[model samples]
Target chain A: MPFKAINILLLPLLLLGVMVGVWSYIALKIPGFPTPSEVWSELFVVLSDPLYNNGAGDQGIALQLGNSLARVFGGFAIAIAVGVPVGLLIGMSKSAYTAFNPYIQILKPVSPLAWLPLALFVFKEVNTTAIFVIFITSIWPIIINTALGVRSVSEDYLNVARVLQLTPFEKVFQIILPVAVPFIFTGMRLSLGIAWLVIVAAEMLTGGVGIGFWIWDEYNNLNYAHIIIGIILIGVIGYILDTVMGLIADFFDYRKRGRV
Target chain B: MSLKTFLKIDHVDKVFPLGGGKEYVALRDVELEIRENEIVSIIGHSGCGKSTILNLIAGLDTISKGTILLENKHILSPGPERAVVFQNHSLLPWLTVYQNIEMAVKKVLGSTLSASEIRDHVMKYISMVNLDHAKDKYPGEISGGMKQRVGIARALSIQPKVLLMDEPFGALDSLTRANLQDHLMRIQMQTGNTVIIITHDVDEAVLLSDRVIMMTNGPEATIGEILDVNLPRPRKRLELQHNEEYLRCREAIIEFLYSKFAKDDE
Candidate 1:
């Protein structure tokens, strides 16, 4: 990074550190307030434990985390497979757009949690319902972004495509897909966040082996420390997933097309 | 059977159905013939559908009441035979300059050409538009003029028979427009492809065309006059900007436009 930009960036971080330091000092003054050391100890146990750390009852932390990842990744991947093509189809043809957008509009506002009861009854399996929740939440962003990208393809590009006698398949691949990448990535990033959110909610309802169920179970057990651990873990995991997505998005956004 | 009359547009009319069940005529009774190696320009006020005529020839849009013929064949769909360079430089933002042209070649000439051949063709065309150094840069990274060059390169790479340009330089600043006009005229001469350009700029119409077809404004648009540019070939901007014929043609167009158009007619 340039010195100027780096300095500009550091200014905020320094301010944040000072603010956090002051907050921590003020927090320590309060009676019955748990210090950072206490939080750290609680966090350590969850991070290192083989059992009962932040698991879904008897299930281990590693196993539950793995299960959550699987459901999230699985549902997210499926959403991309279904959402992007559908988005493109929705974005491209006039008739397709007319039909598809209404359905998307209806689905967009309906919370993924609302679908939990249906998913539980229809799926009759804990893991499937959890995956279904992720699917419901993640699919919208991918579809909406893909549609926006495809729809927003420049008129000049279309003219060039038409004049060049580009096959519809070639037009989609060569013209539409590339133009739509930024939008697709935006959707994917959104979908990943949604996947995490919906999966957690679904886990609570389905009572399955994931972080969400573990968090709820800790509350039932009256272990506030374990509950805090579960909450911190959720935030940490969510941040990491979002950061990774942002990096991927930035990579494509900065990557240029042909000369000029 | 002469190559001169490679493209013929006959009695074209376009009408748009407006609000309240009425209609607006965008173009009416338009007829034109462009030769294999000539540059024909259409000039008019805004909304006269000069671009519409070019669109009809390019087959981007259908003419409501007449047919457009290219190479003695009726134009029903867009083909590689005629390439259009639009006013906006429509470089796909995701693709680099090289890929934009390569896409044209790859899509149109894919079955006939290999990868190396496609690269060679695109590279040659990109360089032809003086964009060789920027071939790897995407559209967002480039200047607007450079993007338009990519548009031109993509069009020319196909070796199109007739080039349809709709105010290709209208979006450009004066300096870039003049520079590209020189490049375009030279390219047109070298390739000997017939070109029909639509523009509202009188100087541009006078500078680039062999003959200027003047279009009048309207709710119902039609040609006001056709003025032959008798100015000598390979014009210098500074010289021609002050030439007598150039001034005469400009004056005639201005008079026709102000007298006939510039009105609020229902």
Candidate 2:
């Protein structure tokens, strides 16, 4: 067990070393490929004054992250508000599922960015358009997962509800919701991840003050090192988001409580 | 004994639609009249439709023909008057044992009782099953036997007219099963509640019931024979192990299941 544990810590570090070594060799060969050391220094430069605000188009890293987060959250919240009820209705009713299933199947496979042109044309504002894209992309997972969660409720639990003569409202709140919560949270987590992924691309396309736009802007100025820094930041943030979401999902999941 | 007909399952039939205009007859012309405070068990082979009978009585399933009546009131859909303890002890995993019982108590007795009164009612049932120590624990935290006990407590807490259990202890180990059987017997003695249990175990049927309704094999299973267990109350398992009446009842059920309508597949 100790040897296995040691390998867990050692393996990632070994891989990271190899990656840096390859990058340094490539940087030396090419003129400006931004070696690991260059990105490391660029990270410090970016982090030094992350909250600074110069203007609308020019802001610090933290402010850019904050703007992106606000949009993702805004779109994410709307998705939950709309998706959960729709999911429940479809899940509980045969007729509703029959009606909604075809549209969901058709719309789910379409890329979030595919809606970019239409959204941009209708909204006219870059921020609204970006948020709209996030909303559309994120909502599918929420609806699908919530419906799956609702469908996953055991017949035994529903029988218990019926035998107890629970009102329709009571059945939903006491039986259905409690059973479906873990699934709903799972959906939310997936939706948030999708929303985060979409927000970056949406910002890049729409031209705004976001991490995605910041990376694109750096590319325009030929700041290759800064782009690498932006990529690292996005990866780290996404990892953190997923971790936090997972923890929250586990918290709501009854199966995780104490099943031996 | 009053000999009052507390629950009547008269000429009931359950036909399940198997699509393509085909149907499966699970139960046919099943008739039973349970006395008030009588402990009746329906014993059968795996596919004898014993559970289907229990479901019909609990009003959890529709009767394709005939009717089920409780105290002369026609039973249609599931109601609090008939509570079922499922084989898997289907306690909501999210809630603690105390909370699980409380949810049922609150739902059924909420209109009649205050919040504090509801707490007392829930705690009372929790103690009846001797699970007060583990009441605060969630269903997932408990052992299988303990979960079944909680299932019993939840069913009884509602003060149903008839308590229906579908192979309630069939999932537990032998020792755990014995323990729950003892618990159920003790609870039944205290409350004198009318109970109908569905089980495959021969000894369980004889030991627990005043009447054992032996069901025939399926493809349209019906009551093959009904053996009367006239053994005296407060029947101890150890004592009943050697009792002549207990041996007779157990043998009668075993004969019906294994000799007459033995299911080869299961």
Q: TM-score of each candidate?
A: 0.88, 0.96
Error of 2 at A170 (Å): 1.8
Would you list the clashing residue pairs of candidate 2? none
lDDT of 1 by residue, A1-260 (tens): 55797888899999978866875686579754445556668777766764554433667666777778899998898888899889999899889989888888999999999988898899888888878788889999998999999988888678778888777998898778877888899999988987887777778777768887877777777655666667767788999999999888877763532222
Give one digit per residue, the lDDT tens place, for model 1 in B48-76: 88988888888888779988887779998
Candidate 2: tens digits of C-alpha lDDT, residues B47-146: 7889988888888888999999999999999999999999999999888999999989988898999989998999999999999899889887889999
* Model number with the top TM-score: 2
lDDT for every model?
0.82, 0.90
Each candidate's iRMS in angstroms?
Answer: 3.2, 1.3
Question: What CA RMSD would you report for each candidate?
Answer: 3.9, 1.8
Per model, how many backbone clashes are there? 12, 0
Cα miss at A108, model 1 (Å)? 3.1
In CAPRI terms, where does candidate 2 land? Answer: medium
Lowest-lDDT window of 10 residues in candidate 2 chain A?
A251-260
* TM-score (chain B only), all candidates: 0.93, 0.98
**Which regions of candidate 2 deviate over 4 angstroms?**
A4-11
